[model samples]
Target: MGGGADDADCGDAENKLGCILSYNSHVELCVVNYTMLAVSLVAAGGLLEAERRLDPSRFGRKFVWQAAAFMAVAAFQITLCFVVNCSGVSIIWNAVVAFNSITVPGDTPRHFLFMYLLAFAMALSLDVYYAFTLELLTTIAHLCSLLLGGLGGFMYLRAFPNYGRQLRRPLLGAWNGDGGGGADDDEDDGSTNSSTGSV
Candidate 1:
């Protein structure tokens, strides 16, 4: 964890290796230092599982878009963080966390909403504080990661809301479904399950 808080050359041996390895020392704290690759794998798995639970069918088709979005976020954050703070930034886990903690179906229960907001607040606080404290680039990178995730999630729902499954809610509570949030999964997750019940 030799990656300093504000290294002049984040690419220097002491920082570059650490940056790429952990993306930044403050990231998973101690978890990423020794196992960055493992962490990335786990993040991706978690994202996929969460998506699977949203709609149990046609996971194969959806995988293409999900995978593309994941790679795009990771690459963008990594490049931006390294350039701005000489800090390596890995958005894989961050994006996954953001999407899961924030995406919820309507009628998802009030308790679930509370927990999601709590998690999001904590994450937002950290990013905002870092940005205010002179790590603006860090905040930017992190924000991009979150936005990309949220956007991709909405798109996913709009495209494939599943023809017969009962989706919890619309994207952000009012977008897809009769309101299509989930079919091509790109388009029926919101018309009220009085649906055709097609399999």
Candidate 2:
């Protein structure tokens, strides 16, 4: 009986350790992912401003420096993932594919709505930056930064719920009944049962 209890205790300890490790891994991955995203966005913004102004100096020397910094951070993130032997390539490739696949089919209403909202936000940000800075060139640079930041934020929010759901559902299931039990109960009851049974 004592041996059995010891074995059970060991098993519990192992499980808890695994859970803690998994949680830490997820937190690390999220930080790396966002850091890379920010780096890419900043680099892209710098390039956009350089092109728009057609003058490297107008965007300022610091813009180029910032672009390099962002890329270095992104590289660090990639290296860390590779070192950890995590499935980083799959995540990166899937994200690229999904981004590329987002398109409007025959100019649908939703497509127009998305376009309008995006354009309005871009214009608004530009206007605000210009109004406050009173420098047309610097305003353009800032506007690009705002757009990139907004895109990163949007992607983070979209991915977060799915990630959180995956992480929590298993533990939640063990504590409560299976998470899908309510749905299963509803199905078992039959959606059409009330009207059809009596008739």
- Top-lDDT structure, candidate number: 1
For residues 32-116, could you state the per-residue lDDT of candidate 2 as single tens digits?
4344444334334433342223323334543454345445433543453344322222122222222212211111223232443
- How high a TM-score does candidate 1 get? 0.54
All candidates: TM-score: 0.54, 0.22
lDDT of 1: 0.50
The numbered model that scores best in TM-score is 1
Residue lDDT tens for model 1, 1-199: 1122553335554556455545344554434322433443444454455455555576677677767777776676556545644544435555655655444444233334444545455455555555666445555666676777777667766777552243444445523223233342433433433376533
The TM-score, computed over Cα atoms with residue i paired to residue i, of candidate 2 is 0.22
Model 1 lDDT, residue 41, Cα: 43
